[model samples]
Target: MDMTGQRTLQVTQQQAWEALNDPDILKACIPGCQRFEPSGDQKFAVAAGIKMGPVSAMFNGSVQLTDIVAPQSYKLNFDAQGGVAGFGKGESSVEIKPLEKGCELHYTVHSSVGGKIAQLGQRLIDGVAKNMAEDFFKRFEAELEKRYPPAEEPIPQQSAPAQTSAGVPVWMWAAGAAVALAVVVMVTR
Candidate 1:
């Protein structure tokens, strides 16, 4: 699978790059992260609990950063194993561009999986991966906002709108139901 995405953050490129390298910040941002530790200057070992369909597993992974280009871009090689569930290996590139208000983070990844995960079907796997990525960045961006704040403007509270009352979007509720059904079917199959 190939995936690409970009997000603009309200912080300088330098600050964004620095935060990206911080193990503590990454641990806090990564969803289901059990442990994340730096093994070397640009290498890390991580363990995360992931649930996809019925194939939930604890994944242990290593990531290596190469082709050094400080604060601009770098290549990431990653591999992870999840016992009976499956394994994943991939390569990606992350680029940072300084914007007037903050920074733009662009990433592209080419990845593959095997075992039960691969058997789950491309649409399911892709959707799950995309959701995971979105979740990670949401947390990461929140953390960065807390650490940096805005230079000139104060951050706004994310209170739910009165229309939703509970703040849950109707579409999201439907999506959740759909995913639950899909998971049930996938696991049973």
Candidate 2:
């Protein structure tokens, strides 16, 4: 899947970039993140619990940050495995553009999955990925707001749609797929 989105923050571009690189900030912002530890320079070991469809899996992962351009942008290379559930690997670039009030942060992600996770189907996985992204950003924004409350109340950020295709949310799609799978199994038996 490929993702492209932008968010405006009430903090300076430099502050936003710094927050992105902070392990404590990231751990606080990441949903279901159980452990996030620095491995070495620009590397981290992460363990997270993820629930998609009917399967809840624990994923152990590593992330590497490279192609740094200071406060402007950086590339994130990440890979994770959930044992029997399969694996996911991806790269994303985050760019920060200075704005009048603060900064405009843009990110693009390209990712792929294989094994049992792939058997769950694209639309289902896409929905999950999109929802997870939205959740992560929301948490990040909230954390930033807590740290840097504006003089005046900042306007609530726009939320991306839960489901970008077929007009159904991720959870609904997961439920539908689960029902369909159950039916197929019953009929085969």
Candidate 3:
């Protein structure tokens, strides 16, 4: 099946890019993912449990990230087997663009399936894929918020003139000094 979609992430493109490259973040973000470990550069070992139609299966997969452009885009190649439940292999391209308030993630997926999962019909497979995609991004957004929430604006510090140790304002002292200076200047003139 062919699929395409976009998600607006409440984070900078660079942050989203870094999280995507992090295996731990991806593992946590992926629904039903049990394992996602780096095996080599741009390669990861993946294991996830999923139910498609009525068949529940554990999918062990390899994911390869390629054609990467820092903080912008990458291509993902994935191949997985579910034993009697069949198999799936696919490639997906993801792109991120900085928005006024956040980043927009765009993705395109082209994939195929065979065996029992494929036998479940295209509608079911498509629905499952869509759900997985939505779930992954939803979790990813939450993880990003937890890890790098927007910095709160710092409160302005009060100056001595704004408040005094005693209940009297420091500005009163300054005014008194200024009056004294004026008197001295007038007398000197």
Candidate 4:
């Protein structure tokens, strides 16, 4: 099966890259992911419980990152076993681009399944994969927001009350006029 999609994340490219490579963040974001830990350089050991149609199983997998470009893109190769349920092996490429407000993540997956999972029909498998991808992104964005909240708009600085040509504030002129009027009123009385 092949799948491709893109998401606009409300985070900087560097922030997105760091979260993607973090084992803790990935584990929390992945649906039914029970374990995700680094095994070696650019490699991780993973276990997740997945249910598709009437079949459910715990998949043990290892993922290795390759073709890495720091804070930009990488290729992931994964292989997993679920005993009688089936096995899945695949490669995916992920790319991150900086957007005006945040960043865009693009991913492509090409994977194959065997054993009973393969017998479940292509449409079912595709639907499950799509749902999993969407779920992952929703969790991922929530995590990002928690880790790096959007910067406040600086509270606008109050702007100094619109300075005049002489560099005096316009509010100062109004205050002077009020004071002069008060002085005239007191003298006339």
Q: What is the TM-score of each candidate against the true structure?
A: 0.79, 0.78, 0.79, 0.81
lDDT of 2 by residue, 6-31 (tens): 87777899888888887887877677
RMSD for each of the candidates: 10.3, 14.2, 17.8, 16.9
State in Å the error of residue 82, model 2: 0.5
Task: Say which prediction, candidate 1 or candidate 4, comes out ahead on lDDT.
Answer: 4
For model 4, residues 57-162, the per-residue Cα lDDT tens digits are 9999999999999999999899989999999999999999999988998899999999999999999999999898878887788899899986765434674578
In angstroms, the error of model 2 at 19 is 1.0
Q: Pick the candidate with the highest TM-score.
A: 4
Error of 3 at 125 (Å): 0.9
- Per-residue alpha-carbon lDDT of model 3 for 1-189, expressed as tens digits? 999888777788988888888878888888788999988888889898989989899989898889989989888899999999999898889899999977988889999998899999999999988888877876777789899976876656775447668767766877789688544420000
User: In lDDT terms, how accurate is model 4?
Assistant: 0.86
Clashing pairs in 4: none
Residue-level lDDT of model 1, residues 1-189, one tens digit each, is 999888887789999888888889888878788888988877899898888887899989988989869898888898889999999889988899999868888989899999888998999898988888887887887889799975564535657632356778755776699688544420000
Tell me which of candidates 1 and 2 scores higher on lDDT: 1
Candidate 2 has its poorest 10 consecutive residues by lDDT at 180-189
**In candidate 2, which residue ranges exceed 4 Å CA deviation?**
152-189
Winner by lDDT:
4
Error of 1 at 10 (Å): 0.5
- Residue 73 CA error for candidate 4 (Å)? 0.5
